[model samples]
Target: MGMGRRPAEADTDPFSGGIFNLNESFSDRIGDYLLGSPNLSLPVADETFSLHPFPVAAPLSTTNQETRASNGHEAAEGYDMGISEQVSATCSCSSQIVVTFEMVEISLHLVTAPKGSPGRPSQAAAMNIEEFLRDHKRALVSCEMLLGCETCSCRGEYVMLVISICRKLLHSVGVMHREGLSEVQNRDSSRERGGLWKLDDEDQAGVLEVLLKIRATRLRRLVTILDHVVTSHDWPAHRSMTQDLVRRLAEA
Candidate 1:
């Protein structure tokens, strides 16, 4: 799990609420708003259209102080759990775009294991899955087939293939083992950070449902997360409900 380049703001990556600003004593705190985009505002630049970023906040936090206290490991677990839920919502969607996004996020959850965790094997498998998801996402970057595939067949040139954006910090006991992800890997993609987009409601939920279909075990966890996100939208993040369901899974 040794990636090349590094992200520009790797140190400042927002795992919790410290990255947003809402004037509620700390950051933006856009958890509720991000959970379900009522009116998404995507920007068009240089004649290229794409989805927007995750807004000015995270959709799974409350107090900025609490976010500060929680380290990357805890954040990784919580975020992965949340992501699982999102996959379920889109599992039913038949769109390739939605399916691609869900795969990318699930891949992120699998690959983003930090160092020092006793589950290195699990973490390695996760990274491999993440790489595959990214490749799949890249294949769908441009409406025109970037790669020769059954769905699309278009030659390159005068093409604005922005591709996909995926990121995660694998951690274990507060240490990030897999480093140097931002290196100059892809010839087309100079930096480690590639372009990403904020999916709309139907697209977002549709993507989740597709993921659930691929991994049935995810359905239960995703339901728990959906209920939690809908309940308060103003409480601290937790996966206790989902964890209870997963207690039955075994390494066997």
Candidate 2:
């Protein structure tokens, strides 16, 4: 007799004629459907489904490593750029400071006077007083010689005028020296008393005024001496010296 198959076993059998194979039939129908309707899509075993194209995500470990490497490279580049900028700024500031220092030095040189220059007030004052005293003494001697000269007949009025000028210059010098000594003594006494020795503006102005007046008087006396020498005609050499003195005084 032929072996009989059970209903459950027949349903489970792949070769059963009543059963349909969905895998084979669906694959064949999918191609037909895609061909008939150009927009249709089918599911595939090795791919993920999506409405739009997208890159497949990698495993978390590999993705994290790649990201970290990229971030480290970017950070290195940024750090290098920052260091270069800071170096450039430091160099620029150093150069600016050097230039500024040079400018300040040049300004100081321009403002300060050289040593031993005639513009120094103390030196000028001492030299002027010495020269003035010498010139006055010489003029006095010249006038006396001319007055007593038997070779030339000198005018009495001119001789008297020159002598008076010389005497007046000598008197002014004596008075100025006495006043200066007194002022020095006063200053010393004030310092001994523990007082600060400061010159007031008004006192400075008054001293300057007196000095100007003294210079004016000296100039006048020099002019009188020159006039006497020219009018007396007794000393040609002395006339030249007097003229030189006048020129020096004017220059001063």
Best TM-score among the predictions, by candidate number: 2
Q: In candidate 1, what residue range of length 10 has the lowest lDDT sum?
A: 165-174
lDDT values for all models: 0.27, 0.36
Candidate 2 lDDT (Cα, whole model)? 0.36
Residue 138, model 2: lDDT of 37
The true-structure Cα RMSD of candidate 1 reads: 21.6
TM-score of each: 0.20, 0.25
Q: How big is the positional error of residue 78 in model 2, measured in Å on the Cα after superposition?
A: 99
Q: Which stretches of candidate 2 lie over 4 Å from their true place?
A: 1-205
lDDT (tens digit, per residue) of candidate 2 on 118-200: 44334333323223333333343344334444321133333334434443444444444544334433432333211122444
Candidate 1, residues 203-250, lDDT tens digits: the string is 433333332222222222233333343233222222343233334221
Local error of candidate 2 at 109, Å?
Answer: 36
User: What is the TM-score of candidate 1?
Assistant: 0.20
Task: Give the CA lDDT, 0 to 100, for residue 106 in model 1.
Answer: 53
Best by lDDT: 2
Q: Report lDDT (Cα) of residue 42, candidate 1.
A: 26
Candidate 1 residues lying further than 4 Å off, grouped into runs, are 1-94, 115-121, 129-252
